[model samples]
Target: MKPSNGSTVSQQSALSTPSGPSSASASAPLAEDDPEPRPAVAALPRHVFSENEAEPEEGRTGDTPTLVFGVPASDEPGFREELLLPTYEALRRAFPDHRIEWREMSKFDLILAVVKREVDLYVVSSGFFAYLTHGAGSSWLATRKIPQASDPEHAVGGLVVARAADDRYATIADLRTARAAAASSQSFPSWTAVLGEIANVTSYPEHFLGKPRFTGDSGLSVVERVLRKETDVGFLRTCEYETLVARGLVHPQALKVVGERTSEALACRTSTELYPDLVLAARPDLSDSVRRRAAAAVFLIPESASGYAWTVANDFRSVRRLVARFGSAPSEHAEPSAALDRYKYALVISVLLLGGAILYSVSVSGVVARRTKELVAVIDEKTTLEQTARVSRERLSQLERAGIVSELSSMIAHELRQPVAGLVNYADGLALYLSGKQDPVVEEATREIARQAERVSSIVERVRAYAKGKSDVRQPSDLCVVAKRAFTTFRSGADLTGVRVSGEFLPEAPVSGDPLELELLVVNCLKNALHAAKSSPDGHGEIRIRVSDDASGEKWCLEVEDNGPRIDDAKFAELSHPVTSEKFEGLGLGLSISRVIAERHAARLLFRRAGERGLVVTLLIAKRPVEAEDASHGTGGMNGMDGTLAAPKAVPASHYGADPSRNVLSDE
Candidate 1:
């Protein structure tokens, strides 16, 4: 609507009418007929212009601002009531603490108001910034509006008519020929826009329509009269048509398009097309920082009121297509016309980004799962191989012991050969003496030949015991009886060899093992002790073999300790090694095989130095009670006739050896 004449440019014109003396600066007062005291604050910053400073934006937060919004070049608001809140509500919702100022100004003047700080900020279409700064040299520090996320906009356009009655105006072509009810000459919908914009003049004669019907009001009101059937064909925005139609007040079948205008900012509908409708500009002189921030805040307002976003300092190239598409023909929006259109680019980028995120997660999972499987397999195989290796080592130990014993048997046989040869010579002498006559010495000679044969036989038996590993032939025998039997049987040469041999008779410590094997082990040690003593001329050491029960409540141990010599740990260990003697005169097999037999009977052979001098060889043999004591008397052999420990008749000393060192070292 036109402002009151007293408040418009008429006041400026009348200011020049006063003929009083005037200063060269034209600073003269206007005619004072309309007198109203202007408030002192009116000349101050807050009162210079009014919108934001006059009311609270919302929560009344910071300084109250004066907000002046640029008017759309067109008169219609396109968004439906469902989406668009009134401007008052939009400002309240955005700045809850501060009041917002509102104004209706020309789009270009709105830009100047903001530049002069006469307004806080304004919202506009995309290319408005380009217009202000194109050659204005202020674009360097400006911020442009472009959304980072998707947002939708709402906008509409208008068509004009001379009247609303379709009966008189069957179509726009018919009305154009009659008369027109156009907007002001400078209005986009009015006369000047016919040639397009306020500068161009074309299309109608001044008297072509009845003396121009002087409506002298806003463009929207002129269109309203036609809808009321007061005029013929005229122009307005499509948003205006939809609003009246939505309020159940109008119908589209009542009119037809006889003319159209074009723009790069508006979308086309089957009903009308025109310039894109939006706030098109803001002032350029405000600090670039504040201008940019306030522009963004306006866009942050609900799209229901202002549409998608504000154009801060954006150039025009981006929106030209949208701008070019707008016109005054009513039509539906067209389908996509190119791959690089906004919607297409958005869809392609979205798919690529989503696919990349999914592939990244899958790759990480695949690597972790594969490594777990590989490590698990390695651990399982290592455990299985270790068990197999342990079993293999035990079996190898047993084989080594058996090999040494077989080799030792042949050496022992050679040791006994000489005694048997001497027995033959002695038997022949006794036979010759008895055959010629019964001499008194003849009986004595026969007894000596028989003793020689017994000595040789005992040596042979001990060697054979080791050959069999001594595990099969077992009997219940007292450790003491076993010791004594070996003593009497091989005790014949003990004194002659200066090897005193004796025993501690712990008769109750009975054991169950091969009788011969027990004798071989005990006698072998005793014989070794005696020989060691005999080798010393100053030696008076007695080989005292002891058969005793260990104090450990459940065991029987045969301890044979001698003072013959002090043996070292190395010699003691070597004595039990399988092939140690294969390279020496001592076969070393005796102790090793004895230990094997001991293990079979759940026993152990413990050898160590004893009494600071001699060796202690103990047979920690496991025992069982003897049941058939009547025949053997717990000795290992049959004996009873004289209540004495009767040794079997033995071979004699006629088997004396020249190389004593080559003797088998057997004392029984």
Candidate 2:
């Protein structure tokens, strides 16, 4: 917009005005003929800005003139609103006939929006205003006047802070190895001013402190890094530091000011030269009445208004001087069309040079390309033949191993059967004789002999089935029955002298698997648990076998826990691999074979530490179909003495293990 003298005033021209006196800096004297000052503090309705807020309805109609003010660039979304809400309220009251609207956006976005005429006014940093006026141009309407308590003059300084306990750095020169953090690269006091001070000492300023970390856009965020020891030092605006301490956001004694710059105008400790605080800018074409009213309304916002007040716009030459010295502003001299025109000749020469080289290279390599393709095809064919030969060799090896296992199984079955049958016959005859004698000692001996015979016969049957290549017949069986049977046999017959064995069977734990195989799995786990417990530091130890559903209720767990020395986490897998046992006199194949059986039943066998002193082995299987329903009614089927049971239709079963108090099954 042109002035009354018919000359257009650029943004630079506006900022070039003589510096206003510091006392009148809070409220620049507007036209002498404006309205008298109203009370600075006025109460008004508050509106919170969020994604859910309804758009202001006051300016929708064409009758009331609407003015939109853009928020400044700050890390915090609420920084501008918290400080400017009171000022906005005052403007609404002063211009009751008009509508006032606030638009929230980032610093860079706000600059672009105002320059493009998308927004009418903006609260921006002095450095930003200077950079804008240097190129795209800006119109200065008013500037904020923070109190001398918060800010001494129109300018604010940069504060460099380090931990109070850190004694390595007393000044900026001592920051050679220190890591630096700041609000952002765009912040003047946090970044540009500090850079200006370092540039005066050395040309390569990075040599002084390496690269600085832009921690975040908020002053508080950068300060937090220093206090948390995440960074060695922090830089932020002097006013920001004072304000944080005043508001109890941070404690003053926690941080020490380094390389403190003394300024009578500055009421707080700082490190770098002070630059102007945030300034208010407006579009050059804004109507005179709106501009005047806005300028007046801002000045009326009182000190009790939470530090909200405006002074005459200060000459922002200090900001320009710093920016020009440090070369911090983005390039503004390039025009795409002019740049293209200037580089066209060089572009033509480069394209011509590249085309000639490509033509020569293609002419020389045509035959070589064809030969290379032929070589690659021959190599691929050879690779394919090698892979096929390797597969054939592996198949033949597998067949040979299968044949050996079959022959071995048949021989074992044939050799073990005759002795097993003879042992059973002899035990039966002994039992018959002992029954007539009715001697308790002879009767017990005969019973043990019969049990051993039965065990031999069971092994013979299992070997015969496998020798004939017949898979074990799997049937829906109650696992609780299988677990109890195995526990009863192991506790009665195994030589566990000092070690105590215990079992808790949850009834109706149904699973689909071979009952004999499941029994073998349980027996091996129990025997191992007994051995481990006996070898533990206590010498006399306890083993507990538990059968229950998992937390998910979809899986069942058969867990055997023993009070044994815990295995380290790194060697748990080694226990499952076949290795000769140091304690037992055979290869350690019991647990490994049990794992195979578990896989056959679509289950997993896992070993883990139980509490701090023992190991627990768990076999996880799919839950039975009716398990959940039975649990709700407080019933898990009854215990059938025989191991054959599909579903339990009765009450829960009893515990099955040898009593520790009894001296039966001694090691001797």
In order, the Cα lDDT scores of the candidates are 0.45, 0.66
RMSD of 2: 22.3
Clashes of 2: 6
What CA root-mean-square deviation does each model show from the true structure?
27.0, 22.3
Model 2 lDDT per residue over 153-245, tens place? 436767888888889878878777689998677777777888777766667665678568885456666766776677898888876776555
Candidate 1 TM-score versus the reference: 0.30
TM-score of each: 0.30, 0.40
**Which candidate achieves the best TM-score against the true structure?**
2
Error of 1 at 181 (Å): 67
Q: Indicate the TM-score of model 2.
A: 0.40
Report clashes for each candidate as comma-separated counts: 64, 6
Q: What is candidate 1's lDDT per residue for 29-146, written digit by digit as tens?
A: 2111213322211211111122222222235434544344433322232321212223334444554433444454654454444334455444443333333243221232223221
